[model samples]
Target: MTPPPLAADTHPPTELARVEFTALTGERVERIAPISQGWGHLSWTVRTTSGRYLIKTGIRRPQQADLYRQVAAQQIAAGSGVATPIVVAVGTPDGPLQRPCYVQTWIEGADAASVLPRLGPQENDRYASALGRQVAAVHRIPGPRFAEDCAATTTYPTWQAACLSRIGRLAASIEEKAVLPPAVLYAVADRLKTLTDQLGNGIVPRLTHRDLYLPNTLITGEPAGAALLDWEAAAFYDPVWDFVKLGMWVFEPHPALRAPFMAGYTEFEPLPDGFHERLTLYQGIEYLAAFPYFGSAWPDERMLASFRTLLSGWMDAHGLVGARP
Candidate 1:
């Protein structure tokens, strides 16, 4: 089976080997950093004779092969006033570049996640507002059908199956690494099954980032420029999935995270009915249940601290703890 390519597969991409400069664009590839933690297509930054641009190219072939995702994102961002990387050039991988490529204006500065935790409460709130408004802009993009084009966005029916298959992998990782007790594994499995059951009960779908945590958001304070990049896993699904994932990652049911995210998301106040329960459902089902699967790989303090935070947040949100000796 072919694995997905790094998203935005392009010359000078962060992951793929940088390619030779071509005449089509004057930009020169200056520095490159493998966009780790990103998927589907590889992306990189290029410093040209003119200016910097974020270039992405396609990867090893998949059914949704080519550059539709880039086009769709650029179109959506442009129409909605979202601060997206400006679409520059879209083309087939130039000869040596077997994959398709796309060029967009580079976003300077850092990802918002980097500075979020350190900011003062006011900064945090302001940034959250920026993010909310930015996300709302993208979500507002009009698509005849709101659901993601699976092939275009690196998702498929296989994705749901992969999550299910993760159950055994989670248990094996726990047993292999001995991170937690056997009972804990069983408990996680039980909770996951219940959570997955809620996936499509009402079919009230909305465009979702699917992975809209802080890391993916780029921010500036003056005008507060914010952009949501990397649309590989984005799809039309329960909109709450995005917000809940944000809460889970930021503080694990910490209402602080939800407050601004939800606020900026709407022009007027929108009630997130059953918001807490919905929030808990996603994390308990998604993050907590999947934690054991990574036990073998992410065993250090970073991993430990993250889970400790998760546990604290989970317990605080819903009075549930397992096998605490």
Candidate 2:
């Protein structure tokens, strides 16, 4: 998969970010530069008189509760022995940022995406394994309920309910956009309804990174020393939901490392029965959701052709060719 353009020339440092960083850390800012920014948040690498920190403010108004939850998620990951940036402060930003923001101690590392291609076979395997173990450690932390968003009040009582809510929302978006063929959308949605029960019986609500892939990970010090980034999307859900991103976006693109990564994850929790089926179900839903999310952001033919390939492959794998749209 093509990498998103780096936030090199964009997301220039703003006075609001600088002001908020100073207010949170109580240190005079010596230097501040943009790290990266995406749909949800704007991030910067800051050096203060006392120390360096990562200051991230939302692109628009993010819920104050979600801000607290992001901090909670980061703290939970750190407690699980996962290397996330340490949170310093989290709260409502004064202005211009237009939302709640947080500060974290800056970690020194190169993005795992940039570093992976440079490694030898052994080094790649070792890094993937280390990352797997770290992810599994975080999954061991349990939550009170299953939620897509991190807000406590919005959580669903059952894993099935949460899964259905996610599926319903994505299906609605795709229908509204009318980008995907109705037949393709209906077939996946129907198959999901039949298979959603599989998720119900064995799944447990655990803290999930929600977004975990090479781009969100950092290789620090050594390839073995890694850190998971971007906890704003973190939530309490089935761990396999996280693997949808890891397997499809990460492992599928880098097939050679999938085994080592799983080897490390299975060290913590063995793969459950019907793991492949559950993964396939989530992946189909993810592909459907991408239409609404990426339809405008990505070029039309590129997006449609990619989806046709992915969905066609999925349908073919499950003997749905006779049912293909």
- Residue runs of model 2 more than 4 Å from their true location after superposition: 1-13, 36-40, 60-66, 95-99, 222-224, 296-304, 321-325
Model 1: per-residue Cα lDDT over 247-305, one tens digit each? 55654634575677667777633545665556566565455544554455434556665
Model 1 ranges with Cα > 4 A deviation: 1-43, 47-51, 57-80, 86-101, 108-110, 114-123, 140-182, 195-201, 221-224, 251-258, 296-301, 308-325
Clashes of each: 17, 0
Residue 252 lDDT, candidate 2, scale 0-100:
85
Candidate 2, residues 206-309, lDDT tens digits: the string is 88887888888887776346778888778898787788889767988999889998898899878767778878888888777778766744446676667768
Residue 187 shift from truth in candidate 2, angstroms: 1.6
TM-score of 1: 0.63
